[model samples]
Target: MTRKRQGQQGWGPEHPEQHYLVQPRTVAGGGDVRHVSEYLRASGWRDRSKRGGPLLVESPDRTLRVAYDPHGQPGGWTIHGKATGSTQEWSAHLGRQTPVEIVAGITDTLPLPRSAHAPNVWGPLADGGWHARFEGNSYSATSPDGTAWLQYRQEANGTALWWTGATDTRGNSWTGAFTPTTPLHVVQAFSAQLASPEPVMRPRGRVPHSSKIRTWSVSVTPSQLGAWQQARINAARAATWARNSRRTDRPSTSAPPYANAGSVRTRR
Candidate 1:
């Protein structure tokens, strides 16, 4: 019996079935599948491929799948399994951002988790302050000049709690994590710093008595103050109108006789 000699039977220029088999095309920026697969698995992705078809890895929950195809068009890899069927492609040489990082970045852009205890006033408060609650976190800010604001947030990670704060005046910010306790004193210190008035700087040397004293003052006539007050009132009215309109569009839920009234009276 004569044994048929084995020969190259796959695609590519040297293969006998080059015309019938799909040509291996270069994925722009995708250098090598081996390298991509190595990096992905090194970054905590689990390889689920049993027979080595395409490079397939999934998140812990299997909600996300990152697949690498050497012959895939546009790019080499596809990020799919999102509810919207939204997909992102990546090539080896093009994107320095990893697939996992990209998914995390997208997740961060989503709206904060809504809470039933969320503040009714979504915008700035009447006393030049603002506060909101979302996903068990509290956010607060005080804007004395509208443009310059002091903001703070208390965030938690499992059993750990921390505080982050920022001031719009000088764009100063701070984050304190891994504290043994709640670190309420740090928040108090930040609040005090925000409340402190800007220091008045003067020349060390005494000026000549002949020089006139320069002073600054903000003057608002009664009419101007009244107009400002009216503008705030109008804004509040508009916000209330929009909120009521949204509620009207939704199905009404059964409530006790004083449920709505009680909610209105409660302070967040």
Candidate 2:
């Protein structure tokens, strides 16, 4: 997207969808954590939290850890993992300034195993018809309307930062950044959301990096809420039904288990 200048920062009194906006209360605003955390617990990861400390969870093998500490230096959210009994280790972090929605992109895919095929960060952008620019190890994709963008700098060791952002003609913008090792699910989640054409429901509150007066927001209606919720439920049910049907078609020895753990527990 072209650099939106810091000029007049207000949308006209017309269609709110025509302008870029921030909605913190909506799933677009990073509201996926509670559900994902519950998913993790149900999928055999242990809740390792202690009173008045960072909310903590650990993989069954004790090699992976996710922590949320308000006072954590450089970043308030961190995920660190190490191979059991080996020196190999990697970490991904998101600063407090990072959008909650973007953070959800990283956490939502933690349960499954990684694919043998490397994560193709560009594939989603290409499918979305965004203009892509590539150079040695750096790449970026900008939305057709110049309202959203994704930037990546790849390193063999997966430490380079990748940025995702949105902007409007009003100079209002939002951004979140993470390392290449942030997890493939995060990349997919961010890409899927960016490519979707639906609207986000946001409650009234100040956005993180932009002025509230600069963008437009409307109260969420009951019908809108019910419709969105029903859609979500139906989509999930369809997915489950399809998966079960496929399983029945063949004699399957096994499939990926959530976190590959049989049970979850809290620390004694």
Candidate 3:
């Protein structure tokens, strides 16, 4: 219908106001390594002689030498933690490919949530590895070919569909329909709007039957799209406001801002 521009407080289906903000990791070593002294003590050996002679003391047999690399060498980035339950044992390889390289003990690591810890659940493959969260129950759609159209999907079904731009050889934008089958579930129908050079989100929905299977429509300009987006956002905000207003609790105030500030109003 319309394209939404930045700066609007209200959000809509296509352009939800929600932003996925990640908490920044503050500490080095993936926030694991704590005290320098603690790390040194736990490491196999320290440069006690300070001559760079061997970090680890030689065993009587002289079979193995344990050394500590606080920072993984060459790259200089610290390797603090290891993955648990990995089928292939992960190791630090220097210039050579070795099974294990002596590393500083991983002091601590954070545990992932049980629900998402499994490999079955897909993680966001977007720009960065961002976890995708749908706001206001939105939908996304895609098609395999420009000539042939397919369905659209809601938030629940969004994960099932892949956003491969292959459908449009020129690699333009895609459009799809979100049809509500049940109160909780919806479906997607899709078509490509423009070529890869200039892309835009197009709208698709079930039209009254009798016409041909395909229909052609003109694309809206950026300015026109902006106005439409704002209109939809305003509508959604108004709806949310109305819904909340019905359940609002209006408290009666008896005193002015400065009068009897701590006292509660009592009705006789």
Question: Compared with the true structure, what per-residue lDDT tens digits does model 1 show for residues 153-209?
Answer: 354664433332222222122222223231232223223323333211111122111
For each predicted model, how many residue pairs clash, with residues at least 3 apart or on different chains? 0, 3, 12
- Best prediction by lDDT: 2
Q: For model 3, where is the 10-residue window of minimal lDDT?
A: 20-29
| RMSD per model, one decimal | 30.8, 15.4, 25.5
In model 2, what is the error at residue 53, expressed in angstroms?
Answer: 2.3
The list of candidate 1 runs beyond 4 A from truth reads 1-29, 72-75, 84-268
lDDT of 2 by residue, 55-145 (tens): 7888767877777765766545677777445334556665444445455445544544444566776776788788999877888888776
Q: Model 2: residues >4 Å from true position, as ranges?
A: 1-36, 84-88, 114-118, 144-148, 154-186, 194-196, 206-268
Q: Which portions of model 3 miss their true places by more than 4 Å?
A: 1-166, 173-184, 188-226, 246-268
Please give the RMSD of candidate 3 to the true structure: 25.5
Q: TM-score of every model?
A: 0.21, 0.55, 0.19
